[model samples]
Target: MAGNTEPLSPRAKLAVTAGKAAAAVSRAAGRGSGSVIGGRVALKLDPDLLGRLAQHLDVILVSATNGKTTTTRLIAEALRAAGPVVSNALGANMPAGITSALAGGSDAKFGVIEVDEKYLAGVARDTTPKAIALLNLSRDQLDRAAETRMMAEHWREGLSGSKAVVIANADDPLVVWAASSSANVVWVAAGQAWKDDAWSCPSCGGVMQRPGDDWFCGQCGFRRPAPSWALNGDYVLDPHGSAWPIHLQLPGRANKANAATSAAVAAVFGVPPQVALERMYQVQAVAGRYDVVTFQNRELRLLLAKNPAGWLETFSLIDPPPTPVILSVNARGADGTDTSWLWDVDYTQLAGHPIFVLGDRKLDLAVRLEVAGLDFRVCETLDEAVQYAPPGRIEVIANYTAFQDLRRRVGN
Candidate 1:
């Protein structure tokens, strides 16, 4: 499969030229936010650029509160078994970013793209993807529709407009509820560990009941659907009940869930289950999530913990006690402006571990640590912080911009 190479309309050609120029200037300025800027300017110049560019593309749109980036990357990697694939790597997930990615990868026939939770609908509607992968819904930004049920409603409406097969996490009630209305659905029991925002039924606002792993609503009688593709511990059981063993180079139960979801999505595109799993096994990291970078004579493994649910997953991967960990948090636009979400994180998971708080919002994390009654110290710089950890691997977990900054430092 190959992307359409036909010449663009005069309006689109002019828009692309201007957008490319803007991206070049932005990148030269070293701001690193140029990817979306170009797309924004392009879309402004030609409003229909996204739909125009999406023509003849076998697009897969993946959206969720967490794991969207990794899941998108995993699916994209698997799709390479089919043909050339295009995606906005490392979580550039917005309308502009999606446009920029499609524009740049003009010859890639298939696209596996990550989209922000709020923008999921527009992208799905525009691209009309071959398959839409729904991971899980969680309370990410309280300032911006922190109520995930509402976002689920938005997703339901958006997906209704899309002509795509929906591959959703059956274990996540929010995801199931949102995707249930879709005409074609493939359910995967990709486990949902974070249930803080899913206590109430999105349909009836009734209290939900969980009997073991299955959940049902008390008042409205909503319940978990039997999954077609399921993840049980170390194996992913297919629709025929054949289990395929999966071993990931990345350590974390969340990555296992991500791996299962990726394989499920790949199957929709005719990629064999075993072949998909093998391809996913090759991923050591998605951007900096599990990359080991040597900075100042110390090996630092970067984990991007953008929300409390994300923190919950990554904390389990941290080396217990003795080894020092550096946590960086920032209250930038990419990360929500309000940092109150810190209160929801179970910081006590690292109760006895030696933690070094870093970044501009290090003090905020320190306050949270103090409230949690955990022992922690402050580190001013990454190089100095690298000195504190003993000879083994040092873990550095940061949110959005902080993670992006450190990733750039490591790459440079």
Candidate 2:
């Protein structure tokens, strides 16, 4: 004879216990979603369950060579002001990172993830975002990505599967030409004088030159018309005499572009210009790129100099007369096979500053410093470099891996 009451199975009892445990942990943490790390583990344990949980959220995918992290974080923060948002805010822009972030969130209306160009297609395949922003691409890490042309080809393929509304930088001829194929695209560009780089029309391989601030090709004559949303003038704050000022804690000319691009993305998300401007002003700086960290009676300015483009822009921001510099060369294999890009950077600007070069590739950096006719001293260790660095004014420039090493050594 069967009992009138149903007995709980072993699996059912385990599920109930797990639910109770999760609730307890959530209360203990004093935060919602319990713990994202635990949630990631749970998703890794069961993908089907994770997918079921993530079906309702809208996704936004943001990509670019530079400024992706800052833009992603800014967008996430602005979206948060509007409603609930889940984001991979820690510069984990890979497909695996995105998968983990999405799986970790228990309740969110949307998901924003920055995607690295190398992995953009893979990410696009997995999550079809409602909107996607493609910032300009520059010559960076040639050994890793081969050439800018190859990177363009990758993006050309990567964007095919995207169903989202595409937002692109029109100032970059290559970016615009590559993205023109997308029917639903919004162009966000800077003023005409801002066209300093694109030498050829990606559309027809025609030699292109800037006539005033407008770019036009000689062969195919592909010209980028004025943008729907364009920022004019050199000042990041009020490029067009607007009430909103471009306030950024990040230093450099590149950061101005980063801030503009972030504002464009935020605009698309329905953030009011006033609110977005306020958000931009509120941001002091990201962790590593031009980040200022204070120690016990010591100040450290972490300037990220990954490649020629980054360095050129970064050095331009050191104001009120230049100071002494500490240069840390890249040692990581991923930085690039060829370290010859140093010649392209303007080392002459630091002529007065006594430079202290340190890193695994300290010899290479020292040789470049000498060749550039800049004052320099070689140091075998970061500690030696820091110890020798003048007390009053010293700026530290490091590539990605070297910055990490220096940070660890400096106790930052």
Q: Which candidate is the best by lDDT?
A: 1
User: What TM-score does each of the candidates earn?
Assistant: 0.95, 0.81
lDDT tens digits, residue span 106-166, model 1: 7787988899989988888788788999999888866775488888998988787466889
lDDT of 1 at 351: 77
After superposition, which runs of candidate 1 have C-alpha atoms over 4 Å from their true positions?
Answer: 1-7
| Model 1 residue-pair collision total | 0
Per-residue CA lDDT of model 2 for 321-361, tens digit only, reads 34667889875775775787776777887877768988888
Q: Candidate 2: what lDDT?
A: 0.66
lDDT of each: 0.86, 0.66
Return model 1's CA RMSD, one decimal: 1.9
Worst 10 residues of 2 by lDDT: 1-10
State the weakest 10-residue window (summed lDDT) of model 1.
1-10
In model 1, residue pairs whose N, Cα or C atoms come closer than 3 Å (at least 3 residues apart or on different chains), thus clashing, are none
